[model samples]
Target: MSGMTPDTPARPEILAPAGDTPSFLAALAAGADAVYVGLKHFSARMEAENFGIGELTRLTELAHEEGRRVYVAMNTLIKPGETGAAWRLAARLARRVEPDGLIIQDPGLIDIARQAGFTGALALSTLANVTHPLALEEARRLGASRVILPRELSIDEIRAMGAACPEGLDLELFVQGALCYCVSGRCYWSSYMGGKSGLRGRCVQPCRRVYSELARQGGRPQGKDAPRRKGAPHGRQGEGRPPQGRAPLAKAGGKAGRFFSCRDLELGPLVKTLLDVPHLASWKIEGRKKGPHYVYHTVTAYRLLRDHPGDPAARKTAQDILELALGRPGVKARFLPQSPEEAASPDKQTSSGFLAGKIRITPEGGCELKPHLELLPGDYLRVGVEDERWHATLPVTRRVPKAGTLRLRLAKHATPKAGTPVYLIDRREPELQRLLGEWRKRLDALKEPPAQDTAPPAGGPRLPKPVKPRPRPDMLLTSGLGRGKEEGNRAAGSTPGRRAVPALWLSPRTAELSRTLVGRTAWWLPPVVWPEEEAALSRMIDRLWRQGARHFVCNSPWQRAFFPQRLPEDADLLAGPFCNIANAAALAVLAGQGFAAAFVSPELSRDDALALPAQSPLPLGAVVSGFWPVGISRFGQAALKPNEPFMSPKGEVFWTRRYGGTLWIYPAWPLDLSGQRREMQDAGYSFFARMEETPPQGLPELRREGLFNWNGALL
Candidate 1:
C-alpha cells in the first residue's frame, strides 16, 4: 500500500521561513513544501516582524489552499508567571490558526499544549539541544514528533542520529541559514551581560560584539586584581598604573575584532549529501528575520538540489540561484568533519549581505560611495557592523551607476570611517515587488479569523500525575575532586543543620575515582555530549550503575538516555541547571520523564526562581554559586588563545577552555548567590548548588560578587 518501493526513497520536504507577508508569499511562489513562521510573541526570533494570531490564521488557510503546510514557532522559554499565558495562547492557536505543527523549545510546553487541546505535531526546536544519536529516543519520549538537529553536527553524525530516530518521529536538518558561534540552547552571554536571555529569545547578540585580548606575560593573563607576591610592589585599585613591570591586561588590550560572529551556513550544492540520510523529514532554511528575496532564492535553490541530486547541471543552477541571496559569506560549518571550514573568521567582517563598495566620509560629514555593482532604487544597504554602534541600514531612493559616486545622507552621529564597506542586503526589484503587491492584495481581501474565547479550557491543563517530592540536600558540583575528600569534608562539617551533598562531574576517570560509596554520590553528566562521546558516556553510565551510582543529574534532558531503561527502584534523576528549567510547566514535563527534582535555570531572576516551587510538580533547586559559562562552542577562535583572558569593550573579562569535544567560554569571576541561599531555602527550594571550578593558574582572583539575574528580570 506504500507509495514507494525499496529502491526509491520519498523526497524530504523543503521547509522555508517567513517573517512577514511578502516572505510567506515568496516561499509559496518558490514551491516550498512547508513554511514556518512565528507569532508576535513567544517566538525564538523576537527581532523579526512576526505575525499576529489573526494574520497567521489567514496565512495558514492560504498555505493549505496551496497544498503546503504551515508551522508556528512558539519556542521561547516560558517564565514562571508567563506559563498560564503561554498555555492560553496555545489553546487559542489550536482553535484558530490550526497550524500543521508547533515548533517549541521548552519540554514543559508539550503536555500543556496537549491539555490545551493542541493535537498537531510538536517539533523540538534545535534550542532543545537534541545533539547526539542517543538523544533521539529521549526526544521521542519527551513528546517531540520531530527533532531539529544542531547546525554544528557533521553529515556523518546527522546520519547516525537519523538512524537512531524512533519510529513515528522525524529529523530536520539545517541546509542553509545563519550559524551561531555557540551551540544552541547553551548560550547565556546576553543573559549574563544584562538580562536579555537568549533562551527567551531577546538576544541582543552580545557574541557579535568586538572583543580585544588582553596582553599576556608568560602566557598567563594579569588582570587588575592580579595578586602581587607579599614583597612585590603593586598599585592599589584606584591607581591607573600596572603592577610594576607587569603590564595590566585590560589597559594594554590587543587589537579588537568580532571574535565570535559566525558566517552563515550555506550548503548550496552540498545539500545533495543529505539525501542519503534516512528519517530526515525536512531540509530547514533559517531566516525568519530575512527578507522575501532571500526567502525565495534559498527555497528555490534547495528545491533544485533536492529534486535533481544526480544532475550536475541542476546543482550548478542551484548554486547560481543561491548566489543572488544576499546572506553572510557561506561556510560548510562543520558539516564535513575531515575538511570542515571554520565558522568564525575574526579577521574578516561577518556582517550579512554581499559587499557592494567602500564608503568615504566627506569633509562636510557626508558620505559618498563608488558602487561596484549598479545600485537600484529601493535596494537596502547596511553601512557597518552593529558592534560599532553607528551601524545603520538605509534604502536607496535613486539609482546609481556602477563605479559612479553617489552621496549618502549622513545621520550626523554615524561616523563610519573612510573605506568602511557597505553591503547590499536587500532589494525590491519591479517583478518581485509586483508579485508581493498582488499577494498582499489577496491577503488583505481574505476575511479575518473569527474572535475566539482566549481563556484556557476549564480546570486548566491536565498536568501529569505529580511525583512525590524527594528530600534532597544542598549540592556541590565539582570535578577531579575525589569522593574521599568530599566525604571527609562532609564528615568534618557534621554539625551543620543542612550540609551540601557531593555531585561528581561524570568524566571517563569518574569510574576509577568513585570506587567506594558511589551510591551515596550523585553523578553529574556534562551539558554537551558530542556524537563521538556518546558511546563512552553511555558505557560510563552503565559502569557507574553497576557500581551502585543510583543518583544522577542530567544537565541536558537528552542525557537521560545514557542511563539504562531499567533502573533500580531507589534510583533518582534530577534535571540540572543547564536544562534551562524556568517554569512550573517544564517541571511537570521533567517529572513525567522520571526526573526526581530539578535546578531552576541560574539565569532566572530571584522573583522568577522563587515563585516556581509553589507551582511545580516536583521539588526544585538553584545554583546558588558557580562560574556559569557565557557560551559554549565547537570551534575555538584561532586568533584568540584559549585560557587567556579577553576583554569586551565594556571591560568584562572572559576566557575559554577546551573540555572534551567542545570549547566553553566562561567569565573571569564566578556567580555567587551565597548571600541568597537562605532566601532560596525559605522559598521552598529544597537545595542550593555551589559549582566548584578550578580557575586557570595566574588568572586574577576578582572578588565574587554577581547574583547573576537574581535581583533583576531575566528578559
Candidate 2:
C-alpha cells in the first residue's frame, strides 16, 4: 500500500466463460462485459475444446467491435522444455489476437510475457496461491496486474485482501462456479495418482470419484467391510490389493460415498454484498467446459441480480433463471465461513445436471423412462457421470409429460443397466433458440479483421543471465533434539554421522527449540499461512529474527513480507519447493524479490529438470527424498476418518493427517530421489532437501517407488 491511491468506485464487470464457439456467441448475445477463453493447449481446462490461434484472433476482433474485452487463459504450469513454445504463444496473442488480458499461473511467465513484448494486463491465476493480505504487494511486484482470488476465502477475508491490494492491481472473484475440494494450486491428488497434473490442467478429477472409507488397524485398513454401493461409478482405482487369505481387521466397518465431490458455488443474492468490497473489478463465472446453454443462462441471471438487486420482481425472475441453468445444487460454500454451510453433502449426488428420472430397461431391449419433469424435443440426457462405463448422452426425440412413461428403441451398441440414474444436462427453449439463431447469423455475417504479421523473431526469446552461484550445501530438515545443557553445546547445523547440513521446520510451538537451534539451523517456514494465521506467523518470524536467525526457507514467495524491512546484506532467503518454481524466468522474478535461492518443482521430468539449473537466475534446489504429500486441503471430510487409510474402488490407499488448521493427504509410498543425488549434484544444483515429515501410525513403510514426475512427463 506504499504509493497506492484509491480509485473512484464503479460497477464491477461481469466476466463469463467461453469454452467453445457457441458459448462465446452466447456471452456476446447476453451482454457480458468480458469473456475468458483458453487456447487448445497450455490451458488449465484442456478438457474443453479451446479455440485455435486464428479463431481466437477473429473472436478478439468481434469482442472488441462490440466494446467488450476478451481475456485469454494460458494459466497452466509451464515445464522447462515448453517455455519456448509458451513464449511464442504469448507473442502471437500480443500481436495478432491483441487480447485485453492474459491470465497466467506460472511466475516464470512474467518474464516470458515481458520478453515476448506482451503489453496486455497480466492476471495471476488462482493457482498462484496469493492467499494472505501480505501476498498482494508481492504479486504486483511479480508483474501481475490482477489477482484471481481463491474460492476458499470468506467475505471478511476478501475485504481484508482488497484493502491490502496495491493501486493499479485489480481483484477478480469467482462469484459462481464449480468448487474444487482441494485448495487451488495446492492440490496434487490427480498428478500424484497419475501423471495428469492439475497445475498443468490435465486433472482427471480423482476427487469426484467414489471412495470407501476404512478403519485403520495394524498399519493397514480393513477392506472386508468396504461396501459395494449399487450403481457406484468407477474410474482409476488405487494400486495394491487387500491382504490375501486373511479375515478383515477387527475394526472393519466403513461406507462408500462421493466424500470429496463438491457442490457448485452460486452467490445469487450475495452479489449485493461484494459491492462493498474494495478493488473488486470482475465477477467471474467458472466453467469453460460447460455448454452454451449454461453460459447464456448464468450470465443473464448474474447480470439481472447485479443490476436490480432491490427489485423484487427482477430478483424472483433471476432466481427462476438460475434454477433452470442445469448446474449442481448450489451452495454458498465458505463465503460466510463463520456460519459456513457444508459444501459437500455425502448423501447427495454431485453430478452437474438435473435428476430426470430412473431408467428401466425393458425385456425387448428398449429403454423406458418415467419422466420426473416435462421433457421436450431437443432436451439432452446423460445416463451417468463420466467415469461410469455406460455413461452416454442422448437427445430427446419426442415430448414426454411429467410422470409419464416413455419407451424408446435403443442402439444395438448402447446397453444401459436397469435402475440407472439419468440426468437432464442441456436443453434449448424456443425463445433461447431463436435468440441463438440470430446471434449465429450476425456472427456469420461479420467481416474478418485484416491479417497482421505476428511471427516471433528468428532466435526466439533471449534468456536472462544466470545468478552468481552460491555455496549453500544440501540439508536435511528435522525436529530439533535434546534440551538445556547438552543442547547448548550441540552444533545445530550438522547432525552426528550425517554429511548434510541440518535445518528445523518453524512452528509457533517450536519457539524455544528454534531459539536453541538459532544461527546454525536454517528456519523452514510453513508451506501455507491462512489470513487468520498471518499475525502469529509474522510475530514468530520477528521473534526468530531478533534471536539471530538469518538463513530461512520461505515456501511461498509472498512470505518475504514477514522479514524485517532492513535486512543484513548477507541474509540467505530461499523460495522453497512449494513455491512451484520451474524455469529460469521464475527464478529471475524471485531473485528480484530478494530471494537468494529457490527449489525447482519436483514435478518436472528428468530432461526438463536437468535443463533448468544452467539457465536459472537463482541458485536452484530440489526435494530429493521424502514423503511428498498428494495435496493440502482446508477441509477434512466428515465421512472419512482422519489418520485412517481409505481405498479408491480400484484399491489405491491414502490417508489424511491434520496439521494445524489444514489437512494433508499422502500416498502409501514416499518420494525418493536419493539414487539421483549424484546426478543432481553434477547437474549444478546448489543444494537438495530431504523432508523428514511424520507419517500416521498404522501406516506401513512401503518401498519408495514414487519418483513423482522425474521419470515421466508432467501432464
Candidate 3:
C-alpha cells in the first residue's frame, strides 16, 4: 500500500515549541507551521507561562491568521480521581478554543478528547516513546496522525522505523537541543532524590548532578570513607550544598562528587545526513524553557538550510546563529570522535569532524582511515569546508606491509585536504612507479568484471524462501489486585466457585490487608518511607504472587528493579512513571529489555499519541487520575518528602530541586472524562485508567454512560 495518498501533504509540518506569547510570535515569524504549548494542570512544563482559556483563544486566532496551527500540551499523568477532572478540562478546550490538534501523553486524556467532540488531529509526544512499528500501528488504530520518533535513535534505526510505519503515519525527530541520556524521556532520578516526578511534568533534572558512587563488593558496602565513584564526569557535586549553608556530608559513603552532565546536541553540520532520510517528516528544536532569541536564531538557520541544500552561504548562516544562541564557543557533531575530554565536556566547540572517515583506533594507539584518500607522512588538514573552520596537526607514525598495500598511521592530528585529486608522495622514485603501476592494474581489473547469466537458476531447494516476519503485538493485558479499605472479604465468603478479582495488593506493614482480583489493578497508597518496611512489603507481594497474583506496580524504578522475579510466565511487566521513557528510542530499548507496558507522559501531542501506539512493540498504558507528583528521580535513593502541601517558601505550589532545573507541581481540574474515553478508544488502546487517586463515586455511572472502557471492558 502507498504510504501517502492525495490527501496527505507532500511536506510535513514544522512543529515548534512556544512557552509564552513572545516565543509563539517568534516561531510564527521564523516560519513554524504549527506551535505547541500547555495549559495549567496537565502540561509537563509547569514553569512555562501556560495559557488559560483567554490566552489559548488569542494564540489560536493569531496562528490561524498566519496560516499556522496551534497544539495544546495536556500530557501529565492523571491519578485515579483526577481522570474526570482532566477529561472535563480537555472537553472545555476542544469545544471553545478548537486547536488544530491536542498533544496528549495519557490514554485517558485521549478518551476525553474524543468524547468532548474534538475532531482535530492528535500527535504523540516524545514522552510516549513510540519506537516500534507495533506501537505506531496501535496509535494509528486509535487516531494519531503523526508520531515523533525518539531523539536517541541512529540514522539507520530511523530508516527502519520509517520503512515499517503504516501509511498515513508521519514521523518526527529532534534535530537539535539538549539530548536526555535516559530512555524515552522517562526518568525517576529527580523524584527519588528531590520529590519531583517527571511523569507529572515536574522534573528536577538529577541527571545533571554529580554524585559519588558507593562501591559495593559482593553486594556489601565496602567501608566508611570508601573512595566515592562518579556516575559521570559532568554531574553536580554533593547534595547541592543544601538550602541554607553547607551541611556536613552524611556518613553514607559519599565519595565521588557530581558526574552526569552533557552538553546539548547541535546537528547543523550533519543536516545533510538528516535530510537524506527519506521518511523524516519533521525536524524539532529543543528549548521550550529558552527565550525567543534562541528559538528565532535556530529556526531561521535551519529554515535556510532546508530551503537551499548544499549552499555554503546558507550553511554559514546556520552556524553563526547557533553560536550566538547557544552562548558557547560554537557547535560540533558529538560522538564523531576526538579526545576523551572533548567527548565529555558540556561545552562543545564547532568541528566538521563527523564528515571525516569514521575514526578507528588500533592497538598501537593510532587512528585508522576508512573510505577516504590514503594519507602519507605529512598532509594539511582542515575540519569544515565552509565557515567555522577547525584546523589540526597530522603526522604519520608507521606503515604496515600488506600483500600489495601500506597501512599508514598519523603521528599527530591533521585535517585532510578537501576537493582534491589524488596526491602521491614518494620517497623512492622506482618504488613509487611500481606501486602506481600495480594500483592501476588492480583498478582496471575491478572496473571490468565477468558478466552474469540473464535469468536465475530454477529451483534447487528454492532457497527456502525467507518468511516475512509478523508484526509483534503492541498491547498486552494482565491481572492485578484492586485497592480498597475492605480486608479479605473474599476469604470470608462461603461460595467456593465465585470468581475472585485477580490482582496483587501491597499493604502497609502495619495494616494487614489481603485480597485477590483478576486483571491488572493498582492502588496509589502512600509509599512506605523505611527501606526495611518496603522490603517486607515486597516479600508480601512474593507471597501473594504464589497465591495467584499476576501483576504488580511500584512508584520508583529502584523499587521495581529490586522486586523479586518469581511470578509466572503470564505475568505482565510495567515500568511505572518513575522509569521515565522520554523518547521513542528509549521505549524501543525498554521493550527489547522486556517491559510489557509503560505509562506515557502527558506532554505528548495527539499525533504523538497515535504514533506511539503504532510504533510501540508493546502495549501503551495511560495514567488517567489522582494527585500527580511533580518531581522524581531514578539515579539514587534520595526521595523528596513533601514537608508541606502546595505551599513552599519558593513562592510556588510544589517545587523540587533534583536535576538541574526546579520542577513545579500543579493540580489538574478535568473538564470531561467522556471526551478522553473516545480519544483513547480511537487510538486502538486495549487499556486505560486513573492510577493514583480514588475514582469519584459517580465514576461507575460515568463509565456506564460511555465515559471509560479498557479493551472494551467497562470500568
Candidate 4:
C-alpha cells in the first residue's frame, strides 16, 4: 500500500513559482502547497532575482511554517569541472535549508546530492525532455521522489501515462503559463542563435525576434534569395523594433519574413480532466518572470477551480480571473491534435499555441477545447474536421468580424444551439478531402527503406563477435565505471574472491580505448556533438556494436535519428540525461523503442524518482557519481572563434556577467552520491556510480559504508 491513508483528503498540491522572496510569500499566502525557486547558478531564468544560502534558508523555514514545501531549483546544465562544486552545494543546501526537495537537470549533481548527505527528495527538471516510462524508471533508480511531466503532454497522454507507471510515483503537471515552442526545458535555440546558454540559465530568446526574407513558391520564405532590409533608423537589429508602416503583403508569395512566435498555454477550463488522472500529486503554475498581479490572480483562480470543481459560479469566477491575467485576448491549444486548417501557423496571430489533447466541434459551431479552459463567446475557434482544418466561431452567426468577442450578431432564421459547433458555412468538403489525400501521399514518399550494407567497407577494421559470459550466480554487480590501473591493483590485492566489475562507460573520444579491453565488460557513452556529426556517431555506434560492445548511452533525442537502421536488438540502450524521463508515459515510449535501462535526470524530486522504477518497464541505473554536463547544445559552437572563448554580444551570462566569451562555471557544490545509493536501494534498484572523475580519497571506501561527504563551494 502507498503512504497515504484512505481517509486522507485527495487534495492535489498547488505548486507555485517564486523567483524571489516577494513572489514566494505571495504564492504561499495564495495557498500554494509547494513553491519552486532557483539559485544564482544553474537555473534557467538568468534574469530572475534568485536566492542565496541566507535567503533560501529563511524562505524554506517560512514555507515550512505555513505547511508548505520548498523546492530549490538547481536546474541547469553543468560545464566541465563544475559538477563537483554543484554536488557539494546541493548537499550543503539540503543540510542547511532542509528543503523538501531539489529540482535538478544533471546526473552528476544527483550523485553530488547523495554524497553530501542530503536526505531530501529529488525532482527531475522538465529540461530532461523525458517522454517515456523507461526514463522514469531510470530516474527512480537515480533516487527521484517525483517527476514533473513535460508541459506538452495532452490529457489523454497523461492518463495513459498514469495507468502505465509503476505504483507510488507522483506526477506533476503545468496547468498555466507561457507555452514554450521549443521542447520544455531542452531548448538551446536562444544559446545557439544568441550566446546565452538556456541550460546554464542564460537565454537571449532569439525565437521571439522578427526577421525579413524573400517570398517562396509556397507560404514559406526563401532563405538565400531574400534581400536584407536595413535596420529601422535608430532601431535595434535583433532587439525589439518599431513597426515599419507598410501595407500587408499579398496572400501570394511575398518578401516579408515569417513570424516565429508561439502563444502561452492556458488550461484553465480542463481542470476536471486533469483532476481525473490517478496518482497526480501536484498542479503547477508557470511564469517566474511574470508580475505579482499575474501570480496572485492566476493562483487564486486555479485554487478556486480545484476546490470547487463542480460549481458553475466558481468556474466563471476562475475564467474571469484568467482573462484578466491573460490580457483578455485570443488563446489556442498548442500540440493537441488539429487538422492543417485548424492548426495555428507561425503567421497566425494569437496569445497562445498548440495544446496536447482532443478537440471536438459541436454542431452549433461552438468548439469545446478539452483540457484547455478560458473560452468565451465571440471567440474564434479552429478545429480539425474530417482531416482538414476549418475556422468557426462560438454561437454560429451569418456574419462575423476578424477579431475579438463583440456582441452576438445572428440571422433572424438562425437558431444555433448552445453546445453545437458552428463552422463557417462556405467550406468545400470535397476540396478539403482531395487536398488531405495529396498531403498524405507526399508524406508517405519521405519514408526510407533500411540500409542494405551490413558489413564494414574494405580497409575498415573487422567487426568483433559477442562473447559469452562465464557461469556464475544469477546476481550480477555492474559498476558503471572502470577502476583505474592503480585502483584495480589495490582492489585485486584486497579482495581475491570478489567478482570483477563489468560495464565501463567510455567517452566518445576513447573509442580506441575500448579495443584494449575488447571481449571484456564495456559500454559507450556518446558525448553531445554538433548536428552535422550525428551520422558519424551512428557509424561509430554501429562499429562498436559489431566489435563486441552491446550496451550504449545516447545523450539526446536528436541522436536517435542516426540509429534508425542500426538500433541493436539485444543491446542495453540507456537513455542518457538528455532524454529527461520525468513521467511514466515518457518511460513507456522509451520501452517501446527498445531501451533496456535509462538515466534519470537530477531535476526530479526524490519522491518522483522513487516512483519511477515502480511505474517503469525496465531496470533503473541511478547516477551515483559524475559531473554530468548540464548544458549540451549546438549553441556553444556559435561562441567558438579561431582562438577566442565563445561569447555572445546579445546573450546574458547566467551567474557572472563581467566574464565574457564562452563562459563556463561550476555548481555551488557536489551532489550526495551515497544518499542516492541508499535511496535507490530502498526503492529496490541496483545502484551504479557514473564516475566522470577519479573517486575522491575517501569515496571508494565510503561506497562500502554508503556515506561520503564531498564539499566543493558554489559559484
Candidate 5:
C-alpha cells in the first residue's frame, strides 16, 4: 500500500461503486481514485451485496493505506421512527471507520451526523437534485462539501455548473453506467408503477419495460385564462426538448416510445471535456449493482485514457476494449460540445451486446459467418438481420474460424437467412480470463488473512423505543390551489371529536393575490423556487410568519437547509414525500430536527405504513387521495394548463405544472386511501385527504383511483 506523499501528482479522482468486498478489491486493483460502498442496510442500492458496519474497519483501512479515499453511502430516506437506529449506526461508523466522506441524501441524516459530532466531509448525493448553482449554496448551508451532480445534465450545463464550484461546493459527475430515464431525485415512476421505489433502492426499472401504446387522443386543452406555462428557453435545437442526440436502442413502438428508455452512460470520448472543467473534483462510475468484470474493464479503459491523453495507439486500444467491454455500441455524447448530429431523438432502448460478425444459416444446417471479430465458445449470439428488425440471442456451441466464410455451431433450433448480422453477448472470454485471475491475486495480496471485522451487538446504542402511537383522530385536508376557495373546505368541515386541520400550500403569486389567505393559519411553501421568485417568496414567508404562520411543509435538502434559519423554532415543520421517509429511523431523526410531522411516502404499503406507528417519533400523515406526482423534471416542456390533463398514447392523462426549471408530472389516477382510513387511524398515523379542485360531476368521482402502496407489495 502506497502512502499519500507530498511529491505525488494530484490526479483527478476516479470514483467507483463497490457493491461488496470483492468489487471493492477490484476497484483498488484497477486504480479507482476513491471507492464508495454501502452499509448492508439504509443504502440506496439495497438489492446489492453490501457491507455491514462490522466490515467498515477493513474497507476504510485498506483504502486509507493505499492513499485512496473511501465514502460510505447512508443515502436512503429514513422514516421518523427509524432515525435513532440510523443515527446510532452513523455514529458507530463515524467513530470507528472515520471515512473520508459521508455521501448522503436526507436532511435528517445530515442533522443526525452533525448531532453525533461527525467531523468528516459530507458529499451530497444526486438524489438531493442539485441542478443549479444556487442549489450549491443551499448544499453548503447543509454542510455538504461536495455535490454529485445529476446525470440528466447536458455537458454544457455541467460546465456552467462546474464554474461555480469554487464558490460554495465542489462538483462531481457520473462518468459511466446505467442512466435513469427520470432525473435521479425527481422520479417517482417506479414507486407508482411498481411497489419498488428508486429512492429506497428497490426500483423495478419500469422505464426498461416494454409498453406499446394502444391508442392516442386529444386531452383537455389549457384555457386562455390560465397562466401561460413555458419551459427552459431553447438551445437552438428546441425549447426544453426530449433528450437530444443518439439513436434508439431497439425498435420500440417506433421512435416516440423510445424516448422512455435511456442509453447507458459511456463517456469515454466526452470524458476529456469533463476533465477540462476546472474545479470538477471527481468522475464517478454508477454501478454498485454491476458485477466485478464490468468494474475491472471499465476502470482499466478510463485509467489508460487518463494517464496517456495524447497517445492515439493507446487511445485506440482502450477504445476497442471499452467497445467490447460495453457489450454493445457505446452511446456517444450527443449533448457534449462536439458530436455528429443535432440533439433530436433518444438512443436505442435495447442493447444487443458486442457485434460478432455477419452470418447466415445454410440449408445444410450449422452457420456461415464472415468471422470479422473474435468469438469464444461460451459467448451468446444475437442475430439481427437487416431485412427485418429481426433479433434473437443464442449460445455459441463452437467456433471454427476459416477465411472469408467460417464454420460455427449454434443451437439446433436456430436458423437465419444468409448474410444475417450477429452479436456476441459479453461473457467470460479468453481475452480477459487470464487477466481476471491475475487481478484477483493482486487484490488478495493487498489485504492480510483472517478478514478484519468487529460488529457491535444489537442494543449497543440506545435506539428509540417502539411504542404504539397515541392516536388523536386528527386529519388534515389540502387542495390544488397553493391557496384556493376549495382548499380548506374538508379540514374546516370536521365533525365533533375529530380534530381536522386546514392547511393550504401557497405560491408567491397566490400569496400576493390573497393577503387574507397568507395572513393566517397553516401553509406550505414550494421546496424549489426560481431565482426571480426567491425574493418574493422570502418576503411572503416573513410576512406570513410575523402574522403567525406556523405549519409548513418542505420537500428538498435545499429547502430543509435554508428554511430553518428563516422560520422560528416554534413553527410546526413538516416534510413532503421528496423527503423520502419510509422507516422508523427516518422519522426519529426528523422529529429530533424539530419537525412537527412528516408525510409518509405513498410508496409504503399498507403493512409498512401500519408498522410506522409503533416506531413513529412524531405525527405520521398520508395524502389519502390526490394526483400522484410521478416526475420532477429539469428539462423538457410539460405545458400544463391549470386543471387540464396531459394525455399519453396509452390513453392516460396526467395533470402537470411547471415551476422554474422543473416540471412536475402527475398521473391522472388519484391515490385513494379513504377505505383504509380507519385501519390507518388504528395504526396511529394521521391521514391527510386531498380533495380535487373541482370534483368531477355525476356522483362525484375522479377519472381513476388507486391504492398506491396500500398493499405494501414490492418486486
Candidate 6:
C-alpha cells in the first residue's frame, strides 16, 4: 500500500540530489522524500565529490532514520567482462544498505542482478532512452521500477506517457538542472572531440564553450576544413552582413543568444498541473555536481510548495526565497514553446545563471543595469559586450531609487555598449550565505550522526547458475565507411580478414562505389541518415538492391517503413540504436515492419544483453570495439586550432570530426572490449568490432587495447 488512493492523487515525491555528505545531509534536512547520490566511481558525475562505497550503510541509516530513501547511481555503461564485478558490488550494497532503488543505465545489469539474486528496485536512468510509450512498456518488461523521462520531451508527450503507463510502472520527471542541448545518451560530442567518454562518465562538457558559426551567403555552410579565427564573429546572418552579394556576418545568436546552450528546465509554475497529471512518480532535481547551498535552497523551496500548494502567500515566499538563493534569472517552465527561441540562453551561453536585468548605456557612456527580478546586496553581476568577446565582473555596490538597479562606474576601461545583456552569475550575497549556514546549523541541532553497519546483511539471495558458453561466431563482420578511399578499397580488395568479412555499412555519399561491391557484401545502410539526404539514400538502396544486395540496416524508427516490408525470406532488415530499442516488445513490434534482426542499444551491459537472448534469439548485434562516439550535433560552425581537439579547462583533450554535414566528438580512447569475448559469447550476441575505414590492404586492422569497462576500474 503506497501513499496514494483511488480517490485522491498522491503528492509527487521530491527527490533531491547529493554529491557529497554535506549535500546529502542538507537535502534530508530540507525535507526531501529521497536523495540520489553517486558512489566514488562509475558515476555519471565523476567530477563530483561522491560517497565512498564504505559510506553506503551509514548514509542509508541516516536517510532511513528520517523516513527518507536513498538511491545509488551505478549508471555508467558496463562492458561484458565488467558486468560480474559491478553486480557483485551492487549485490553486496543491497544486502548491506537495502537502498530504496538502484538507478541503472545499462541493460546488462539485468543479467547481473538475476545472478546475484538481488531483488531491489531498478530505475531506468535517462540514458536508457525510455522516450515513448513502447519504450516505457519495454523497460517494465526488463524489470525497471521507474523510467526517468528525457528532458527533451514536451508536456504533451509526458501526458501521453502517463496515460500509456501500465500498472506497477512509475514515471520520473526532471524538474530543475543544467540542460544539455543534445538528447542524453544519444550524444557523442564530448567523445568525438577527444577521448573523454560521456557514456563512461568522464564528459568534458565542450557544450559550454563559446563556439562561433561560419556561413556563406544564402544558407550555405562552410566546409569542416575551412580556416577561420577563434573569436571572429560569423559572416552573414542578421547581425552584420547582408544576404546576397556580400559575406553576411551571422549572429552566433540573434536576439536568441547561444542556440546550443540550453536554459535550465525549471517547472515551478507547472508544479500543480504536473501533480494532477497522475502517475508522475517523483519530481527530481539534478545537481550532483552542485554545492550544498544549491541543494538546501532548491529542496526547501520545493518542499514548501509541495506542502502548502493552496496558499498564494506560501507560493510567493517560495519564489522569493528561490530568487534569493539562485541569483540567476530565466528558470524556463516547459509550458513555453519547445523551440530554440525559447530554450536557448539569450547570450548563447551555458548559463544566464541569475536574473539581472538588461543594461542601458547611460547618456555619459557609463552603464546602469537594473535587476530584472530580485537582487540582494553583495550579489555579483557581469557586464559584457553583446558578443561576449569582452566582459567585466562587478559587485552591486550602489543602488539608485531603490528600483533594483545597479550603477556601473568604471575607470577608463571599456564600457559595454548600450543594450548589452547583464548576467547575475555569482550568488554569494552575505545574507544568502548566512541563511544557508543557519539552515545547516538548525538541521544539525535536530539530527544525530549516521550509524555505520559493520557487517553485511546475513543470508544474501542465491546467485543464479551460469549457463554454458553458447557462441555464434558466424555472424558476418561488417565495415562502415563514409569516405571514398575506404569505399574504393572495399570494392577492389579481398575479404577484409583471412576469415570471411561478409558485410558493409556505408554512407549514401559512397553510392558510386556500391556498383563494385553490391552483390559481394551485405549492404548495411548508414545508421544516421538526415531528412534532406533521403532521396539519395533511397536511390542508393535501390541501385544496390538491383545489383543483388539482400541486407540493410534502418538507423531510425521512421525508416522501418522506408525499407521494404516484404523482402526475400533470406534477406534481413536490422534495427539501429537510434531507434531507441532496448526491450523485446520494441523488437517484436519491429518484426512486422520487416526487421529480421536488431542491434541492442550500445548502452546495454553484457549481462543485460545476455538476458534478451535467453528469452528469444533475435540476432542482437553488439559493437565490441571502436571509439564510442559521445556527441552527434548539428551545431557545426567553428574555427579550428592546431589539431582541432575539444580542449577542457582540466587539460583533457577529445577529438572532433565532421561527417555527413554533422559534427562528431569521440572519447580520447576507443572502447576496446576485445578481451571480453566470453561476456559476448555467453550472452549469445553476434559481435562486430569496427574495422579500418580506408579498406584493409591485408588483414582487417584490430583496435589496440584501451581503457574499457572490462575490469570496472576506479569503481
Best by TM-score: 1
Model 5 worst lDDT run, 10 consecutive residues: 233-242
- lDDT by residue for model 1 over 537-604, one digit each (tens)? 88888888888888899998888887767666798998999899988788877776778789888898
Instruction: For residues 1-715, write the lDDT of model 5, one tens digit per residue.
Output: 1211334344557888889776687787788889899888778899889886656566677778788899889887665445667777777777677888788877667667766657777888888767665566667755678888877667776777666554545677887776665678767877786577777777756544333322223232233221223321111111111122211121212213333445567778557666666557778887787555567677888887777777887788778767756433345433453552211123342443555677766777667777666555655556762113335656556654533565655545555667666755445566455655665565455544233334442432234665455443333433334334444444555434665555555565445535555433456655445333555666776667666666667665355543545456677777776667776555666665566677777777777778777676777777676555787654443122333333344444444455554556655455667777778887787646353322111111124447776775633
Off by over 4 Å in 3: 1-11, 213-258, 276-279, 327-715
Better of 3 and 6 by TM-score: 6
Tell me the TM-score of each prediction against the true structure. Answer: 0.92, 0.90, 0.48, 0.49, 0.72, 0.60
- Cα-lDDT of candidate 1: 0.80
lDDT per residue as tens, model 6, 94-137? 66667888887766565555556667678878766565665555
Over 420-446, each residue of candidate 4 has an lDDT whose tens digit, in order, gives 332221121233335434533443444
What TM-score does model 1 achieve against the real structure? 0.92
Whichever of 5 and 6 has more TM-score, that candidate is: 5
* Deviation from native of the Cα of residue 379 in model 6, angstroms: 10
When 1 and 6 are scored with lDDT, the better candidate is: 1
Top lDDT prediction, candidate number: 1
Q: What is the C-alpha lDDT of each candidate?
A: 0.80, 0.77, 0.46, 0.48, 0.60, 0.57
Candidate 5 lDDT (Cα, 0 to 1): 0.60
Candidate 6, residue 619: CA error in Å? Answer: 7.9
**Model 6, which residues run further than 4 Å from truth?**
1-9, 214-259, 307-312, 327-341, 346-349, 352-715
Give the distance in Å from residue 591's predicted Cα in candidate 5 to where it truly belongs. Answer: 3.7
State the lDDT at 498 in candidate 6.
Answer: 23
Q: What is the lDDT of residue 223 in candidate 5?
A: 36
- The true-versus-predicted C-alpha distance at residue 36 of model 3, in Å, is 1.2
- List clash counts for every candidate, in order: 0, 3, 142, 89, 27, 44
lDDT of 2 by residue, 552-583 (tens): 99987778888765568868898999888887
Candidate 2 differs from the real structure by a C-alpha RMSD in angstroms, to one decimal, of 5.9
- Give the per-residue Cα lDDT of candidate 1 at 102: 92
